[model samples]
Target: MLDQALKNQLAAYLQRVTQPFELVASLDDSQTSREMQELLETIAGLSAHITLRTDGQDARRPSFALQRPGSDHQLRFAGLPLGHEFTSLVLALLWTGGHPPKVEPELIEQIQALDGDFAFEVYMSLSCHNCPDVVQALSLMAILNPKVKTTVIEGGAFKAEVEAREVMAVPMVFLNGEVFGSGRMLLEEIVAKLDTGSAAREAAKLDEKAPYDMLVVGGGPAGAAAAVYAARKGIRTGVAAERMGGQTNDTMAIENYISVLETDGPKFAAAIEAQVRHYGVDVMNLQQATALIPAESEGGLVQVKLANGATLKARSVVLSTGARWRNVNVPGEQEYKNKGVAYCPHCDGPLFKGKRVAVIGGGNSGVEAAIDLAGIVAHVTLIEFADQLKADAVLVAKLKSLPNVTIHVNAQTTEITGADGKVNGIKFKDRVSGDEHLVPLEGVFVQIGLVPNTEWLKGTVELSRFGEIVVDAKGHTNVPGVFAAGDCTTVPYKQIVIAAGEGAKAALSAFDHLIRLPAAA
Candidate 1:
């Protein structure tokens, strides 16, 4: 049941209900079922143009089928609408009543272009704040396209379904009954798989002989910024990336990014892509870079080879290829990733707030993660394989200051333990005692150092032992016409804003190099 205040808000929202809406509820007579039924009935009772109907004893499953007059069921909400997901239910009701959803035009185009029948079965927890976005996106896609159907199922209500699908995380998306991915996914990502006209084909069409004035590699914040900066100066700029947003997209939440108050990974990444496209930058997305060839002379051309047959030559290049998180690589780790196992404390920390959690790796990043989580989470168990923590004195001091965090030295993470598709605890072995211990936790954060995406540039560019590109303050590398920036470079700190600034600098430096060249490049 909902509060009177909430009911009044829903009534106001449905003021201009156009289509006749009905609640086709199918549920057992359990207490939880009763609550859900009452909630749906209450919702239907408020509007003059709305009605309620039970699916009867012979109904296939206990779920809510939202059917509008003169139309078949367009959407389904499989469980009780509790917590933040209540907003999703409200939106669904309004949507069927002729209200437009806030979806991007390009995304709608992609949805409309879908050729085959596809069903989006989204598994989510009621308490998960991030789940609703995926549900809404899929619903809107279904509304726009006849082939795509969607069902938002609450995890707790459908225990059998959750176990069958191995749904361990909120927003676990299953496309046509198979796990597509877990976590906050964007509309573009889902549509990407369905679209036949892939980027590999798109990359093939770009002229290999013609040289770009400036070519930006990597699609993260740095590359996007570099591409935009280069394009603004009226240069023949092209951005090639496997995916847009780079390492920034791997992050969960960004509060320290200056002006912005709060933002999450998927939304932030989507915004960056949208902004880059708005500037009409020649963005070659989903194109992986395999190798880089430096210019022979000062004003000569540098070549970039893609995994595909396409080759791109440029007068100037900006290597903003970002870093990837160092995974634990233990059993069940990859399978449960984004289900319960997670990396990037800033991105996924809030989801585990007030719950017990574990942080593996005792480096600066690990200790920092422990310190950050200590304030929000109930407890933090930090495990380090080495005898002593490798973090700085200040960070170590700050970590020790937190009473809620427990430190375990010379302990190795053996396995990530979970049941019915989600992570619940961790298996660790003590080096000294040779004893294995299992600590129960709601989530696990891996805070090991990042692996820079500079391996491809080993011989062509000067690189540190960690495979990070060696660069000067102005983003100049060992090669004259080539430059590097962001996490891939030997930057002091890896921040999104810092990378973006570096990208801008790299673009400006490339432009300067282009102008100084005697020959037309």
Candidate 2:
């Protein structure tokens, strides 16, 4: 049950609603039924702009047509309001009413009067609760600017689209028909993209450039190492990573990466970046390499074209873009990311010390997080939709050894519940018979499988059936002068050290190719 204060806040938020709707009542419990009436009344009275529509009320038919409440017009909520979706509903009402959220006036002003329509489609896996922040922010922007239409498609449910769009990660944002950003973007940057047409246009212009001797496409450990080594070898090196640090950025801590004892992700990334920069490697941030094709003229160079219309020529290309963590798209998962929800336990576990927590997924990552959190949290509930843990014997053995950790296999999370802007608990359904119940907790960590970021290379590079990039012993691709390394590539063991080592190999291979190029010329 939500606290009285939260009930009041919910009431206030409900007052902002302007559209007719029905709350998709969770049929799982008596407690929910008991509290529904009081909650509904509070929400109805507090909202100045919204009036409730009972079951038999004059509800308008649902359509894609534009329905206006005012010239101050904004979206009104329709459909089931649950978890993070409810927050979106409230924000939509506020935006439609021309009332900005608690954000600064200047920021609000920046979002206003923006021309052009942008649709953001975020592909998220259920195990990745970190993705909701990206969804919520975009949904809020969509509300603030009617020109923007945002949709968050769960990765698991939309397999066709995932394959079609080559969605390999959670929290991947596709803006204006092309992949815009991944992981997360700050509020200011989002505002800038929303408000400034020129800023977006300039960003789209990163594709205009000449060729280089070596181009490392990823910014992870492997890509960084390749860049540094190539720069040292004095091969007109350039790096065109989507973002620096790759999947390592999501890691909470790295205890096993050799010589890095008790290191955090950001710290590790900084070290790699510093080393790469020391060699005078040309680093282009926030630029995505969309396509790689052989040069038209019979030269050793590969032509790399960016989504933003920038083009570059490179003698060799190293593919080190890493994999993305999978997510579960359950209700409330998107609404509470970082507000008591998390993906990487190592990065966020310490914050939950002494608090009750839940970890989803049966993979090695899930078991690892469960074992790690058991030492920190008061209690740990590990939920797996499968019948048993699929992790290694050592990890599972260690997980079983923990007294504080309780495992629930063949159970799926039905919904994430919260009040007052933080995760409070989760509801689960038994996979066999569909019996559902809620468990209260302060946090939920999702640790499912990872998807390699190699879908875009489908026709260009050879990939494993699972979509991992296939590279040879020296990191050379089937295509000459093109190489791959890291989690995105198929060398097995998606560890940081392995990626770094592979990066070094790819750089050396690229150097070898460059050295022989002039003689061939």
Worst 10 residues of 1 by lDDT: 55-64
Per-residue lDDT, model 2, residue 45, is: 59
Report lDDT per candidate. Answer: 0.81, 0.70
- Which segments of model 2 are wrong by more than 4 Å? 1-208, 297-300, 329-341, 346-356, 375-378, 385-387, 390-398, 401-404, 410-442, 518-521
Error of 1 at 114 (Å): 3.4
TM-score per candidate: 0.76, 0.58
Q: Candidate 1 clash total?
A: 4
- Give the least accurate 10-residue stretch of model 2, judged by summed lDDT: 57-66
Q: For residues 68-151, write the lDDT of model 2, one tens digit per residue.
A: 344322222222233434454455545544555766575566665666777676655443434445656776666666776765
Candidate 2, after superposition: displacement of residue 368 in Å? Answer: 3.4
